[model samples]
Target: MKDIEVNELKERLDNNEEFVFIDVREEYEYEDDNLGAWNIPLAQLPYKLKELESHIDEEIVIHCRTGARSGNAKQFLENKGFKKVRNVLGGIVAYRNLEEEE
Candidate 1:
């Protein structure tokens, strides 16, 4: 269970890196702000696991409002045998802070 800083995640996004990026926040939270990640909503992750089956062995990055939810999501995915699961440190809050810093 590796953790990725928001800076590295932003660089990857800028470079068009290919990976499974998931936002585990609820729909309303996502609608307010997001990184264009696939919205899986932590509560519904179990039901949507199949949708992510193909990416089980790939790099999967998960984030939430403040990283707590995404941390749980990362643990859950790893427990389910996902080979590479990374949680964005500080989640979107840090991500936005990075944006503001620039």
Candidate 2:
């Protein structure tokens, strides 16, 4: 699976690039903080697959609190035939850290 760093993602967001950003963390975590991604927890992904059908060929980035869950989510989406799925390396924690540094 492909992996994207926090900085690159931030650049993409800043550029207003069109892509599907998914937060695979739980609802509470999402409520606490997020990068404006769609809330689709990893556990609920299978059931929500249909909702993402239109985005199968689109650029999809998945992230959680850490990289592990999003890595698994990347594999799962690939198994389900998603064409352009990527995991955010180091996930939201890394993203927040990068933002702080900036």
- The number of the candidate with the highest TM-score is 1
Model 2 stretches astray by more than 4 angstroms: none
Q: After superposition, how far is residue 85 of candidate 2 from its true place, in Å?
A: 0.3
**After TM-score superposition, what is the CA distance of residue 49 in candidate 1 from its true location, in Å?**
1.1
Residue lDDT tens for model 2, 1-102: 468999999999999999999999999999999999999999999999899999999999999998899999999999999989999999999999999999
* TM-score (all chains, Cα) for each model: 0.97, 0.96
Deviation from native of the Cα of residue 98 in model 1, angstroms: 0.7
Count of clashing residue pairs in every prediction? 0, 0
The best candidate by lDDT is 1
Error of 2 at 74 (Å): 0.5
* C-alpha lDDT score of every prediction, in listed order: 0.94, 0.93
